[model samples]
Target: MTDEGDLIAGRYRLQTRVGQGGMGIVWRATDEQLGRVVAVKQMLLHPGSDEAVTEQAVQRATREARVAARLKHPHAITVYDVVRHGGKPCLVMEFLSSRSLAAVLAEQGWLPASNVALIARQISGALAAAHEHGIVHRDVKPGNILISRDNTAKIVDFGISRATGEATVTDAGAIVGTPAFLAPEVARGGDANFASDVFSLGATLFAALEGHSPFGEVDAAIVLLARVARGQIAPPKTTGPVTDVVLAMLRNDPAARPSMRQVHEACTAIVEGRTPELPALGRPTLVLPARRPRKRVVVAGSAGVCLLATGVVIGMSLAADPTTIPEVVSPPTSATAATTVASHGCTASYRVTDAWPGGYQAEVTVAGERGRRLVGWSVTWRLPEGHTIDDLWNGVLTRTGRHVKVSGADWNAVVPAAESVAFGFVGGVADGQPVEPKLTCRTP
Candidate 1:
């Protein structure tokens, strides 16, 4: 609705449009009061959308401004103010003169696995802050991820994000995200959760590395259904840690993935010169409308017997199956736990918090000379289905289906000998139910 030299909200002069999207149009404008160039986003108000939806959108925008204004991370775009332009809403944000992930993909083809991991971690860190404040960003795609002129990653687009459990404004919800990045649950007509945001993060990273979605389609509903019912996944050709990390995050089983903190660590590990091992997708929590009835395949040459928890039965290792995944074994769990070993008057401990949807947590703590001579150490665990690797901290690493591993700085990079170094890992689980931590670590 704005044109060249249009004065917006009586104070900002509109210039050329810097960007536009499903939610709104972003224009480069001049602040008459400050006489500086700025970016203003005029939000769309659809006729079909109701008052509740519009209110929800405004509330969400306010919440996003609250976070974006205070967030100083280089990977996040800055927000300056909120105003109503011509009876509609307008958001003023920092003008980065940046290229989007979609543009980068188009111009550069697929990026290096490490680069994708780097970007994912950056976004995840921002999301972690948002999630801690009960926010869920429903739309996370390549276009929403902006890379500044200096090439720093910036996460944009919180128009659809709402505080967790808040009623949303968009009834147009045929799944509110781009098809390639929509989470299965949201695509299946359910409320988007923090875990769902994690799923979208995984999808964005997947497209960044694979030249396509891990599921291989931009079809929204079909992709959601596939994520809910099917077990088809594979990494792209330009993969290593990238393949591992993306597959782990794009898991169909939510319980099988690491927590946001874990995902952060895994991604950071990639940057820090470490590879993460993926985990098995966890068991299904919410039954899909069309899950193929589980069949009892005979176990062949198995050293350990197949086990099932919560009355769920499994016949064989899913490692051999192409179209299906094996069920998860959830033993009686603890909400919080830490595993540590004491040696030479030094102790290294890893503690976990808020394990849910088949995810585990760890807040590694160190004491004594152990932290002084930290050598390379690795943390390994399973990533269940329905969940994706969201974040990992301390170091970047690789991720695959159900297995995840990480290496850290204090753990062998900086410490000369056996030093106790602290780190942590967290992820979104598939079950939507919180689980207890039960880690059994030993020397190999």
Candidate 2:
């Protein structure tokens, strides 16, 4: 749709059509009086057009009103006003000069660590803000994440959002979200709480880094439901710090999954270079085999750092197998706590999530090779300080003052072909030492 130099609702002068969705059309328009640009969302159907269609359209529009209006977050695209025009509802929102994360991926395969970090952090902030005031963004996907020219991530489309304990646009027991990005809870139609949002965050990051979902191809709802319902088999992301972070977000049990705050911290650590310390937040994490014997296509994890390889670029450490990664990370230094988390000597690039003295986290994702024979994999990193392991998940952990070692086993540690796993740590660090985490992947 073009501007066609048409005035919408007699107030907005349509400049150009930016996007179109299942529900309505989004046009970039100029406020004739204010002389400012705004996004006008005009529903496809009006009330007088058809009773059933109009009712459904109105329900969806009203859903946006309930969530977007109530949630005033910087990461979220702002909704100005919802008015009725031509017997239909029209929504005025802030015009955004950005492209969806999906478009970015389509244009440039997988994104870099820095871009992933920025997007994840901003998305988490949006989710946190929505949760704080009792709202949940039901559909969190690459399409929902819009990146501005300056690279700021803005979450859009609350047309499917749900508020806490409120009536929902969807019928009871109806599934929601794109299958690849759907949280297990939402997939099963059990509950859509803050934890579910965290799960979607993990899926979002996975899609960003690995360029595929754990669920693989999405054909129908029943199949996706079956995949999520099982919640055991995971994708083996190859050659990056993406697997660790995504696995943390895909916990089958909501209680087992880390909170949004913790999830943000872990992802931040990977994004900003801060060492991630996962507090035994009352959940037992799963540990996949480091290297699983698969089809005969060798995925070699070269010793040298992989800046960014175009071809498969599988970095698996499979007992010499590079597919599987260490399930648990040992804390660096012992500040007299059970889990000795260290900031010193931890060298790696990490994104800053919630920065406080000694309170830090890092998230990393890894992947296996596509069409390769990967037996096992492991990720190893040292601590800046001496920290103990309060609790461990998925893999084994070994630690000493100023040093930490994590091993991925073949028995339960092998990352199958074309799959990935996530590992994180939670503990305390010394009050003053600045934490820097370094990531190293190895095979036995």
Candidate 3:
């Protein structure tokens, strides 16, 4: 039995066990030589297990660790070193101060689709990089995704990942990975590949948004695997803006699915509130955004920056005088807005919806004149120095230093005459009053 503070390979000193699964036990340990903390995974072998099977597992882990080490991406966990201790392989990995997405879902049940999109965008970036290097992460379930306190997402545990062209490491016809998240072909005992990873990614996202596996949950592993093998994905009832891309990824045919790179791009678009194009669909189909739940608004005052939701007043600070509007740079109004704006351009309004220590929430609504129809719109503004956006939805957010741009998504792109489209964002500031930026809106 491994005890706390036990030294592994005469270098890594174990502190406490952090995780355990069928594959291995992960310990938080310190590398005395490097004076740093790392996660050390001790591959598990059942007591009295056959020696040959044990050796094969050790060899496989060694090879896979080498494969994981070759991958270098900000969104992927860093593999530091692999060592042998007690005749079993121990994987030294970066110790992140984060919790697994699986644990988050287990506690929260489900997340808003916009939040899920942000997570999907990050994980897809890491997985895309892996695919580009010909590495297939045979397992891509929620348990492998770590979300830091700052909300940065990184994919961990590439233990089952294999580089393309690597010889089979597991016993012949032996299936690996969690059953609920497996691609149909893999569930049917086919080889896992990049497309397989994409499907698994879809299943993981499905579980996140829908609160259950795409095949639904079953008590029997054999029954669940059968459902996955048959590609029996239940319809998504709550994914909203992410439904199209998620469904495209979960397509029944492996070849029909978009590449991991494409998935990343699509998720990125979703994070920015733009419609995703699925050329992989191979046919023309109108992709519509799913209905989103409305957020409540609290009106504080009649002046300064006021946030709105669902066309109702939201966060507004009550001024000493109800009629006194604060002096700030507001978006171009309908009158002077004509010359400085486009011929069929739009106008945008900004308001502070909510605020707290070090952070605030805001909303922006873009509208066209009563008789003028605005097609697609993009709003550009600038943030104060040291202020940054944390999260945004219903529009794409692009930031270059203090400059920012928010573009309308497909569903919100075409605003009928007299109607308006809006997007909201949460921002972080360093000890200063939030100021509404002068916004320039244009239509194309």
Candidate 4:
């Protein structure tokens, strides 16, 4: 059996195990001949595997090397060599000091909108390149996305991917791909196509923003697959600016989905600070149930804070005097201001903190009217055309079409008269100056 420190193929020495999955174990190894570091993925052949299973595993390893080797893109992992070591197949590839998107999400919860946009742009470029080569990355999930310390994202693990005209490798009636990220057509036993990859990419972005899969977590594979087939995706509560594109990629009908080229363009637009021009998403055939109201959990403390549906807490500083809160002047009265107003003893002000070619960051501060004590507060605003919020912090954010809402987190739920709470977000704004969003506030 191969162990740490073992030499494989006489030219590579395993230093340590870097990753493991159902199909293989990845090790950080040294290419002795070249004196360079490399990653080696050793195929797994279970002791009790039948001849057919063993053969299939070998073919899969060989296929993975072939598929990945044919494509050359900055965001696609590179394959160096395929070798036979210790009677099993192994693939030598570039070693990256990076963590998978799944690992990052586990550590940081959800990513900011601008960050997700940058990642989506890179992956889309990779997918577009792959599609041009007649390759379909059948499995595109967070676990397969590697992010460097500098935040560059690379797509990896082509273990299940296949060329467009390739003969089927899977057994009859057997499905491939992660259930949580599978496209509806694939879940229903249809062949995986470029569109299917697009759908999967969308689901990956959904997980990056929502901190969970769109299908939610489930213990049973069959149950999860059924949910995917039914297309019962709960609306994402936190994808600020990328919401439209994410939803468009998730269209139940593959025909309605954007092509990888379109996806790349849209994502690039988001990264450049411009709003993406996406195709209209007509009503999908699979009707989703109305969203259930989010439940609140109140944690008692010196300052009563209520955890809202988004798992964000709205906090109040007990030591600060409510009367000391500063009042922000409302934007000059105009047609946009007609729809924006301070109400229910609260007012909100929006300011753009940073801006770039295709992306920008903004912050909102919500102040309570003098002497008004609000148990909870929610701020709503209308985004200008072509704009979308990608990610936010300090509040629970959700969007319904162009209307955006931010609710206080549980820790900041109590707004003692005249006191204020704030949240910030990054998003995309199409041409011209970033439009100032019209704002309104309410208490519940």
Q: Number of the top candidate by lDDT?
A: 4
Residue-wise C-alpha lDDT for candidate 1, range 63-118, written one tens digit per residue: 65664565555666768888876667778877767666765664454677767877
Q: For candidate 4, lDDT tens digit of each residue in 1-444?
A: 789899999999999877654346788899999999999988766455687876786787778788889999999888888888867889898887887776566446578888999999999999999999999988787767888888888888776787878865653555666667888777766778999999999988877777666676442344556677767786677645586788888888788999999989999998888989878874344344434343221211111110001111111111122123222223223312222357887877676655567666566767676646667889988888988776555465656778887887444566555546566666777875577777888887
Model 1 CA deviation exceeding 4 Å by range: 46-72, 171-174, 218-231, 275-444
User: Candidate 4, which segments miss by more than 4 Å at Cα?
Assistant: 50-52, 283-444
Better of 1 and 4 by TM-score: 4
The ten-residue window of minimal lDDT in model 3 covers 300-309
Q: What is the lDDT of residue 303 in candidate 2?
A: 10
Best by TM-score: 4
Tell me the whole-model lDDT of each prediction, alpha carbons only.
0.55, 0.56, 0.69, 0.70
What value of lDDT does candidate 1 attain over all alpha carbons?
A: 0.55
For residue 62, model 3's alpha carbon misses the true position, in angstroms, by 0.9
Please list the residue runs of candidate 3 whose C-alpha ends up more than 4 Å from where it truly belongs after superposition.
Answer: 280-444
Question: What's every prediction's RMSD, in angstroms?
Answer: 23.0, 22.2, 22.0, 21.1
Model 3 / residue 401 / CA error / Å: 62
Score residue 29 of candidate 1 by CA lDDT. Answer: 84
Ranking by TM-score: 4, 3, 2, 1
Q: Taking the tens digit of each residue's C-alpha lDDT, what string does model 3 give over 44-93?
A: 66445587977887887778679988999999988888888878888888
Indicate the TM-score of model 1. Answer: 0.57
Worst 10 residues of 1 by lDDT: 300-309
lDDT string, candidate 2, 1-444, tens digits: 234577766778877766554345677878887889988887764213577767766777767776788988788888887766666777888877877676566445466666787787778877888888888776677667777888877888777677877777664444545556666555544556788788877776766665555555332223444555445334454544445556666777777777777766666776777766565543224333333322221111111100000011001111212222222223344321222222222212222122235454333333443423234555556666643233232234554454565544222234445544443333446656435556555544
